[model samples]
Target chain A: MSDLRSGSNLEKVLKAGHFAFTGECGPPKGANLEHLKEKFMPLKDIVDAVNITDNQTAVVRMSSWAASTILIQNGLEPNFQMVCRDRNRLAIQSDILGVYAMGVRNMLCLSGDHQSFGNHPQAKNVYDIDSMQLIALVKKMRDEGKFMNDEEIDGPPRLFIGAASNPFADPFEFRVYRLAMKIAAGADFIQTQCIYNMKKFREFMKMAVDMGLHEKCHILAGVTPMKSVGMAQYMAKSVPGMDVPEALIQRLRDAGKGKVAEEGIKFAIEQIEEFKEMEGVAGVHLMAIEWEHRVPEIAERAGMLPRPKI
Target chain B: MIVANPKPISEILDMIKDLKKILILGCKGCVTVCNVGGAKEVGILASTLKIARIKGGNPVDITERTLERQCDPEYIAQVKDIVHDFDGVISMACGVGPQFLSEAYPKQRFFPAVDTTFFGGAVQHGIWAERCAGCGTCIIHYFDGMCPIARCSKSLMNGPCGGSAGGKCEISKDVDCIWDMIVRKKMEQGRLDDLVRFKPSKDWRTARDGGPRRSIREELVI
Candidate 1:
């Protein structure tokens, strides 16, 4: 409706009516440019855009803003992620302008993992604003060309704003309303938390469709292929709000030791196929966490290769 | 009430170990109600310090005193006559006590015996949890009297942020996901639409972000 908010590659692909596919790559713990490039290079031509995680899992890493700039230099479009865990409104607004000046056009705002889960448990958290407010703030800066205080901005960042949704979290019925709230707050797209419970996700999507949320913004279902039985078990038991079903774990275990990774990819491909046809799913966010090298293979097998050259 | 926990005995001992004569001052305020700082605790701490000093062969003179409220200037003035007799003082009140004492008696050294934790009430016999951040703005009426500012790990005004599961926070199982409770309460009351409304970014200028806070009541002022 607004002629491409940021004119980003991901926005172009989605607007072109193609089943969009995106990948994720976390920055290295330190400034290892070669390693960072190698980690995300596999996704360069295979996915619509690469999401550079912002200190994902609350573990310290190179700043996402710097990493996103590096990706842009390496001939890749970066979906720069900014978390509300570490920065106040002052720093948040400043970094937004800085990254935008550095050529970042896409941003994913998140209420990051709490500090207690990270290396610095004693660190003070600065959730000066939540993800909902961050979405509205970004929208205001782009649309109204104003800061949070209503001050005029010299050059507002035209970011294609994205917000994360978790359909599997508790108080099940409220999750859809929360998604509506995010959409109302000016989220251009939604990338959900990794989905393992298909039944639950389908129900959540039905509600969203009923509310006609999909017509308002792009919805990309999140999928992370399980690397091992232990990984599946860990996500099922340890990760909060993750809805890894017991049957999915059994499928990984049944894959047997040497074949689980391939089976995991197979499952992911199947999910992608279903998402392509799903009513409200506009795309699939393939988060090949620590498995970036296999993204090309997953994309090819999922029939998402030859990414649209919009 | 202001909740606090006692500092380690070893740390308390290290604080007064260098002093020849010290006073262990307690407050009959929130610290007394919480049982960390009171007449009984002051006496016990004094005896423990004397025994520890005697065992270490540094036998020192000690005095124990309990004020009605160490935060008030009138109560703090009660110690003006004899406060200088001691080389230092160990205040068993909340963090405010030692600072007030130091402010009232600038020439004397005052050490805090307990680490002030949060503004909360005892949920049970011996357990307490944070209930308010004292953000200088109160919005608990919007969430069934629950304060997400103090309870939610991220202080998300619109929340249950993806990490909430089974009514518990992602930080720990012991912590309740206040957002979950808030949503459930709203749902039960058929007021879920209230939560559906978007809450804008909180103006934190009213909170500690504005710097050290001060409150005034002109009607009560003489």
Candidate 2:
């Protein structure tokens, strides 16, 4: 029998040996379920699991947990995300139990954007524990059935744990070791920052593969399809911790006016094709972002449609 | 060293609005070094408070005193004799000044005139930046002499946290990304391996997490 730890469809797909494909969604800034569902409806059958980002970009939005529960109600599996930015450990543990009780099975841990970068710059931040510690804490609760205080949990949530990695982030040589640390801290899988610097990513994967990181945890490459030349330039110049090479930017510019979106999709398709064969890459995580409407076509054109059912 | 900024004059005036007389106590400690509180500042504050009170049509008596160090019990004790004369003492030092004064003269109310900010040193003349968090343990050597606990907006032990851009923190262009500096320094020295190694989850028990930390020196104990 397959381990099927969380019983998450994403876990089932990955364990079943079919290359996994995941999609991302941002909860509406308010409790507008209609807007949230509009984004999810198109992605329901297209990807293995729909990842609901937690206050993405540190901007206040509908809670990722609430969105994930709503996704479950909409008949879609949710990969709920948690950030160690606004909550302390006590709240974090309680929410994990609460989300699990509400039927959420997959969880992504992240060190959220500092509160200073958000709408509430004046707000006090509570990092109580970082994402690395969060991964270990969750793993402990799931595997040992114990809390941070060592008290036993009556029924531990068996979660398929995930984490975010940015291979392009600084101290370039240390990115792989950081991945290893996350895995050691009990991350079962990782979905990295958006893929653009293929050469750097290839080198990063080489190091990860040499360390046999693939054998320890599933690695998913993050793919964001650029919407315009402006978006590419913004990401290349302003967006922190991302590496968008000049060649890709020039390619988008060369696509000429009105054709950037398709050109962007084409670039994403190319990256996905490369990820399919890349060593140590088990899948592609398409973060369609505010551009959720384009996911169905992107997945279809990329031939990832009809998500593998476990 | 401690770093602090003076509270707005309007706020301080509001704090003692009902009082007839008060003392503006300054500290010749970190606050003096930061140019926030000192003997010279005490004269300026005493004059300003008197002027504000006179302008309000309510003349009031004021005393100006600068303690060598408001954090020390000996310096706080020097004002014990005259504390009974004033309705309250406005401490122009860091939060510690008021706290120490309050502890020494429990009957006399001490209002902090300055907000205690952080433990830091001046980066340039008239420009001070935080450098330490007094977490009770020092790990600066591990991070290329940079204190992430006090510098990084997130206090990440292992991070640039995906929000670093153009060598500046996501908080603002003014806050230099300490991780960037650490990385650049290490990489320059061909010591990238130092950063790649795992820095274990901090034992915060010794940090503020343990709550109200204290230090006792057995050998120096009288």
Candidate 3:
């Protein structure tokens, strides 16, 4: 069972022809399980895996380690997130080892947001190690058998390390370079920032293939549905670097106010289809954000059903 | 605050490749105030250097120690024992610290890891710009409070230059033209004629080109 669990999830996702689904499990602001368990109950069978975000947006969400353990104990595969925003070398090193001891193996390492972007703007940020260094730190523990503090773990966690990329926002040339750095730092898989344009997505994939990353690591396409016409406009305008094309905006506008949700779902399904057909796209990560219940329907419309076996 | 462009980290690390033992020395004086050689910056630079060494297959034994001021005689004396143990020392201080450290410990090689940026005053929190060039002359009375000599792109003596486009310097679109700001301030105060008044030519005898600059007070010396 341990060996099976340790295998690359990307392999399983790719072997399954239908689009693979993933969703976020935002940790509540508090520690109580009452709100969390109720939320996990609905996401269990719908998603291939649910990621427990670590202080997402740096607003002090529930501990990702605890949330992942709870979800894992309840029979849901939880992808634990670990950010380098608030922790130094000692904390980061210990947390990676400590979470592994709890039997939660899959991990996503992130640089996290600068505190200015969060609700608590005055909070100090500890970018002690950036995202690339975080990835390298984990790889050092797993591959070189040493932690950041130069301490040897009894047995390193056989974690399926993942990193994030923002092809949509970062410079086109530098985006590929950054992903290459992440891969070199031992990212077994990658989940990109929210994607809106299929053409740009395809170009990004092509660049990955050019860098020989397609064969080395799995690439997961990120898709988020527009909740309303107002939300779509806000995302395009307010969100830095997320360029939702004018045509898609028109489509949403023409669909009228009442059918916006339905139109958004259809657009998401189109993205899932496009992602599945693209060469070297290992899987798709569907981020419902606050709208978790609509994921099952979105998955069904994308013709993606859970295929448990390879 | 002596200005010098320190070598990049990768280059410095490569220069000390042959050394098995490395000491990272940080100055908590000017470098600390400037946010370069502080405790946080020292830790980060040390970690990067260690990682670079380990990954590069050298795997050095690196030690990090920070002193109050690396340029002073007493501070340099305090690190003498620590300096004898290391094959090389990477100083995270401004330009003066490395030379001082080298002069104190001639046996140990020294390298600087931070580029001493400038001699300036704090404009805001974590923001500093070049104000005084350490020239022996004080010319503040001529240009109100603003230092047109240092802040202006052209360093024009009389008034605003034509290179000011939309309040930004023509040389670089990102930076603001200091001369334009000065003109606006003068006009707002109804002293625009002051901009055209004759100003004595700057005395170069007190500048760096003159010789080694020095300052002393007779009462303080006694």
Reference interface contacts recovered per candidate: 0.82, 0.44, 0.00
Residue range A209-290, candidate 2, lDDT tens digits: 9999998889999999999999999988777788999999999999999999999999999999999999999999999878
Clash pairs detected, candidate 1: none
In model 3, the runs with Cα more than 4 Å from the true position are: A1-5, A8-19, B1-222
What is the TM-score of each candidate's chain B when compared with the real chain B? 0.98, 0.97, 0.89
CA lDDT of B190 in candidate 2?
91
List model 1 lDDT by residue over B1-222, tens digit each: 999999998998898878999988999999999989999999888888899899999998989899999889999999999999999999999988998999999999999999999999999999988999999889998888999999999999989899999999999999999999999999999998898888877888789999998888999889
Score candidate 1 by lDDT.
Answer: 0.93
Q: How far is candidate 1 from the true structure (C-alpha RMSD, Å)?
A: 0.9
How do the residues A1-310 of candidate 3 rate in per-residue lDDT, one tens digit apiece? Answer: 1233345343355434435567778878898797888777677777777878888866887899999989888987778898766886779888888888887767888866545556787776554555667777787898778876677878887777888887765334445656776786778778887888778888889998987887777788988998788888987765655668878888899999699889988999898888888887778888888887777778777887664544
Of 1 and 3, which scores higher on TM-score? Answer: 1
Name the regions of candidate 2 deviating beyond 4 angstroms.
B18-20, B50-61, B137-146, B181-200, B203-206, B209-222
The number of clashing residue pairs in each candidate reads: 0, 0, 0
C-alpha DockQ of every model: 0.89, 0.50, 0.02
Model 3, range B43-143, lDDT digits (tens) per residue? 88878878998898888888888999887889989887778898899888898888999999888899888778777856787667787756567776677
Q: After superposition, how far is residue A114 of candidate 3 from its true place, in Å?
A: 1.1
TM-score of each: 0.99, 0.91, 0.60
Candidate 2, residue A182: lDDT: 88
